[model samples]
Target: MKEGPNIAAIAALIGDPARANMLQALMTGVALTASELAQEAGVTPQTSSFHLSRMADAGLVSLRKQGRHKYYSLADADVAALLEAMSGIAMRSGMTRVRTGPREPELRKARVCYNHLAGEYGVQAYDSLIAREFLVEEDEKLVLSSSGRSFFTDLGLVLPSNETKRRPLCKSCLDWSARRSHLAGITGTALLSFFFDQGWAKRVEGSRVIQFSKAGDSRFHEAFSLQN
Candidate 1:
């Protein structure tokens, strides 16, 4: 493998089913402790920890220690982006959905794609912002305009202190099911947090499933002009 590119190395790192499941569960881009993650991947804590360590070594994830507990998450936005792209390939092969009972419309409607935002809900939000001229796209990345700062400020997010003109406002993430780009990046995370804080969405079972309440439904219609 050359220093510039190593597709085989990356593939080998994510090839294990357990590690793959762990990555999928953390696709929401939030930190989660090993126990919670164990449940998600259907593995024992010790086993999960072993996988976590391997992934952490591979630079696929990162861990933080807090008061005797360690929480794990994707190493960075780049890692999240990789998982989203991989999810797209999985879906293209007709592997994302399972016959595991009923349809999760709420989940399908809105949930975290990776670290940024995704799902039908994320797509709609991104589209609305674009319609309002808050952002523009070049190639695949989303560049924010000055208007974007004002728009986000109105929505109660202060721009990250780390942002630079060349860093970009958001990045396009592939939706596993929708097969389209959704907004993701520092900006997308902010919007998702705002939704939770505003009571527009509630996390279900501490998983990626988010249920929009009636108030949320109304608010989406009002704020974003979403009919559903």
Candidate 2:
């Protein structure tokens, strides 16, 4: 008998089409109701409920109660990271679903990955940081340098000090759509929130896309230009 965590069981739970769709929907970092998820998954409400129950039981999702309604979201950042990595693998392996819509280009340009920015713009931001020497790659590990700390502070993104934790302060999250690496971890989430707070980007309703205005696009490039 295998003497470690069971990957097969978890994979089985995510292997179902309906469940996969529901999980993907939750990847938008938004809590959704069963009915909303059913619509997203193209499944009946009863079927969606069954799948959600299984996912919750397996720890893939969590339930939140609000009055008479229940909302579901990915259990935590780890689950979102797993899905993002799997998506990168699937895209590289030529496993894709048939998809087409007006929002396709926008999604390819900018979208949310778990809680942080992703897609072309996300990759660009990461590259700019690297080019500017704000982040350093040491032994395949991403680390924030002294200058990076000061830079973030200047941007009003002062990271909370946590000495007891072992998690990396800055990590690379593979960008499935762009086939590159984007920033992840606590700093990444903070940067995304900054964009929202500054009104530079907005989440598209009922989707994972992050829509940046024309002015926002120009300003973003100015702020994180690779040439700098």
Q: Highest TM-score, which number?
A: 2
How big is the RMSD of model 1?
3.0
For model 2, residues 1-228, the per-residue Cα lDDT tens digits are: 669999999999999988999999998999999999999989999999999999999999999999999999999878988999999999899998787678878887999998899999999999999998899999988888899889889877888665224455787898888989899888888899999998889999988899998888888898788884
Q: Per-residue lDDT for 30-109 in model 1, tens only?
A: 78888888887888999999989988988899999999989998887788777777777887987754663353666667
Write down the lDDT of every candidate, Cα atoms only.
0.76, 0.89
- The most accurate candidate by lDDT is 2
Worst 10 residues of 2 by lDDT: 160-169
C-alpha positional error of residue 185 in candidate 1 after TM-score superposition, expressed in Å: 1.5
